[model samples]
Target: MKLNIKPFFIAAVLFFGAFTSGFAQDNLVNSLKLNASEKSKDSFTFTEVINIENTPVKNQGSSGTCWSYSANSFLESEMMRNGKKPVELSQIFSARNAYLEKARMYVRMHGAVALGEGGQFHDVINMYRKYGAVPQSVYTGLNYGTDKNKFAEMSAVLDGMLETIVKNPNGKLTPNWDKAYAAVLDTYLGAYPANFTWNGKNYTPETFAKEVVGVNPDDYVELSSFKEYPYYSKFVLLVPDNWAFDQVYNVKINELTETIDNALKNGYTVAWAGDVSEKYFSWKNGVAFVPNKDFDEMTVQEKAELFNGPKEEAVVTEDMRQIAFDNYSTQDDHGMHIVGLAKDQNGKEYYIIKNSWGTTNDYKGYMYMTKEYVKYKTTAIMVNKKAVPAGLAKKLKF
Candidate 1:
């Protein structure tokens, strides 16, 4: 069925600003920070290798709109990279647009499309292109008096409305249904702006996006690696959150990891969609790596001391990655941004990933993932076409 291709994934990424000589993350790295591994005498030490300037960290809170949050975060960096002043884009504004669009599709497809809080990263860019963009200061989506995003009640009410509309109790759909659905969004997320003045200039969403945001929606591209398809081809990524069924370019695993390294080194940040549910992913500790020892085979002592220090990572291969992906071991559960690169004492590489779960982790809402871990777990990544290496860009025909 055309509607059966949904992947129930939720992405939760934030920004990772530059970590130069005096940047906060670099300073912390210099201190040899130890998070959960404090119990272990020997802890891991990280040194910044490559970093990019970006906007501040944000919280998705109790919502599953990390796709909007992460994509906005990456676009903020892209604006900075393009020499424009940084501004926080409204993540929920894009999400609000997506919700209505998703609703239209769900009803059109007889509820075959999944309806929930989760979404994929590309949805942000697509929404921006279609509905234009807005500033967070212009629309906060906090009408319920909460300081942060909490969507339980609103989502439940919206889902109930969608269920009724899909059932077509009247035996036929009416035009009023769409208007009624939009009213619920306005009641909860607040009425959106038709026009607003910013920095002494009056602008609408479209004008603001063109005059200030200055991002070429076409400049960015999404890519993934899967042995199921021929390398350098493109296919629809099968994930529940990919409700739009957008196709992503396919490449070898080595090329996939190299693309990120090349982007970080060349003043670009990436939006990551992947699985972080492995025994080794520790968001609280702000450390993630593919350990040589498998969790299932490890003894209690080994499991307890997993983060004691740098250890050998699994030699991730294209075949192994495909196996895990096929068996459901690797899932598209969460999403984040790859803002920089770091190296441990053992010289193993880690991607400096920033999460949208607030500034709560050891790195202050920032975390690290081994390149091996990323290669093994990443479902897909979005980056500027220019950020891709000249040779690889030609190969992928980006």
Candidate 2:
């Protein structure tokens, strides 16, 4: 999909920074030479809906399980939106379930699939269908005796076991392999609850899903953009974390942003999977923006200042998006909820992202990102079908 990015450029910075000698004069004449200290803001506005409420600030804690943390949070909001009180569902339960499923797939495919501490949004749905879910209060996965979800020891053991099993040193594999896998899960997360009570009612996991949380697993859709596929067509998003390879429709960048905003305006929240490694991504300070100047142009002293202060320039472009992806610079590092939009002290607009990293940061687990930052960084987003704009929805046939 062709992403419209000129609207995001604060000025006519040298396109791609690749001016030929013949065009050098023209390039220098028109090249945006604004100082790194100068500032500008986009002229658009947005408001929040799907009001964030009672979101339990759970920590993933040294695990690459952003997928688990994020989707469980998504379902929590789903419960709240449906008039049930909000609940902090156990992300570790979902994570354990997904790990077992992934191990099965890995062995079945002879280890072709990448297996690690990563997964996609669909993993949560699969967990809901396969093993169901429980509130964090029920099974916190703290059996390892840690206060937070730490998977280093557990994941290493699981991966080693799967690798050994996949090799199948014997000519045949054991039929009880699945049982063995479940045994490992039981050890880590404790046994799944066969029947439990909530709000003075008896319920199993499946019953809780059907009667209480009431989230339709099929109601959500994933969307992404890349040139390899036809725009607005469904394709398996080719990311390692997307182990399910669920087909997500490709749309232009503007449409993606539009869908997110429309969803927020209409009282819906979005599950955002994106890259958070850029220097401008100040999760520590709870802000993200594109500085207008290049880092190479700054002196040693000024470059140090760039780290200490807000960058006014950082020559962002469509190609930088491509380069980052191609060079492995942009990656599916984290998942968060885009809960609202806001303008910074400089009047620059930023998408208000609610993160699961706890309320330790200056903004208490929230980050503000500009349009450029979102475009360059987002890997994919899942939102309610109703969140899609009318035009974009019709294009994708909703």
Which run of 10 residues does model 1 get worst, by summed lDDT?
14-23
TM for candidate 2 is 0.83
Q: With candidate 1 superimposed using the best TM-score fit, by how many Å does residue 128's alpha carbon deviate from the native?
A: 0.9
Q: State the weakest 10-residue window (summed lDDT) of model 2.
A: 12-21
Off by over 4 Å in 1: 1-42
> What TM-score would every model get versus the actual structure?
0.90, 0.83
lDDT, residue 126, model 2: 79
Tell me the whole-model lDDT of each prediction, alpha carbons only.
Answer: 0.78, 0.67
Which parts of model 2 have CA positions greater than 4 angstroms off? 1-51, 300-318
At residue 281, give the lDDT of candidate 2. 58
Write the residue-wise lDDT of candidate 2 on 1-398 in tens digits.
10111222222211111111122112211221222222122222333323455375565665666677887887888787778888788888888888778888888899887666677787888789777877787778887777876555666667778888988988799988878877877886687677887778888888877877788887888887665678889998666666666788888766777888788777677888876544455555565666676556667766444424334645455567667777766666567777777654456556777776666555566656776778777778888787788888898997
